[model samples]
Target: MKLAGLTIAYWCVLVMALVPMGCAWLAKAGQLGKPRRQGGFDNHNPRAWLARQTDWRARANAAQDNTFEALPFFIGAVVIAHQLGAVQMRVDVLAFLFVVLRLLYVMMYVADLATARSAVWALALLVNIAILFV
Candidate 1:
């Protein structure tokens, strides 16, 4: 049942799992090297550091949190779809679309495009739902 030796849908899941970390990296970008006392990223208390961010940094962190929230549903949908004997190509394509929409959602969030981001988030949610029944 493996597509190219490692189902494309599963590979999409792995890539989706990494998206939140990428958002975290975006939140921490360019402040990783400065001294903590000078407003640099604080590894000792990362959540504190992240909480103190503003503007796009804050949005990126928010995106990270949102992405994490979405991950479970996406994973569960993909797993359930496979277990239900869904068509492999259809599942794979839907999963891939979900990932693309999610990545776009992150970018729109960071760019302060509230409307577009919300729209993309809704679309991704629909895509995830489709994966469940594919």
Candidate 2:
């Protein structure tokens, strides 16, 4: 049987959502970059830079919370779309948009760009709402 578009979209979302955690794991393992020492003269260590860019613990917590925040909307959209007999393409598109926006949101969050992140988040919310109505 052919897979539903929404199903595929959710799969993509699942994969994308794992990326940050993977990065975090690599960072923690010293695979990505080494941790920075304060007042150090060398500023070229990529791992150290990545580690110092943000609080990994806080980012992990925020990532988990972000996943929690979006999960319900993702589920609701899929269920409503399926129940309404909405076109598969449309449902998939909306779901894809949600995932993309959320991914962007995470990047923005990591970079500490609050305003841009919130805007992207709002767009994702709009997509979720549109899916519910569709």
Candidate 3:
């Protein structure tokens, strides 16, 4: 179903776009309240701050980068699918699946489950490709 004439696939694109921000928040979780000198998130030089992250924080940051890398293809696929007159319901379902898999991938990434994360990433990529052809 569409909200304001935007299909679920389009909504999924918006959600996917925001996923990187959520990953960034996760990367900086728990350190935002302290002073910058005490290892808090640095609004100034944020890239340096994020680059200094380690462990799961680093993983979350990496996930953020990967999510950003994935976004353009997903966006293009949805747009092309719509322009190609692909079935809306199939596209929406695939897009939703892609989102779910990507979210799962992020969780697995943060949890340090490399094998599962890679698997989920592959699945989400396949889902995005399916959206292009649906």
C-alpha RMSD for every candidate: 1.2, 6.6, 0.8
**TM-score between model 2 and native:** 0.66
Give the range of the ten consecutive residues with the poorest summed lDDT in model 3.
Answer: 125-134
Cα lDDT tens digits, model 1, 1-134, are: 47578788999999999999999999999999989999999999999999989999999999999999999999999999999989999998999999999999999999999999999999999999999988
Stretches off by above 4 angstroms in model 3 are none
Q: Each candidate's lDDT (Cα)?
A: 0.95, 0.66, 0.95
- Model 2 agreement with the true structure over 1-134: per-residue lDDT tens digits: 12654366566557655755654553344433433454232346544444454465446446546766677767767777878888777877887777778878777776668899889988988988987877
**What range of 10 consecutive residues in model 2 has the weakest lDDT sum?**
32-41
- Tens-place lDDT digits, model 3, residues 11-127: 999999999999999999999898999999999889999999999999999999999999999999999999999999999999999999999999999999999999999999999
Winner by lDDT: 3
User: What alpha-carbon RMSD in Å does predicted model 1 have with respect to the real structure?
Assistant: 1.2
lDDT at residue 20 of model 1 (Cα atoms): 94
Model 1: lDDT to the true structure: 0.95
- Winner by TM-score: 3
C-alpha displacement of 4 in model 3, angstroms?
1.6
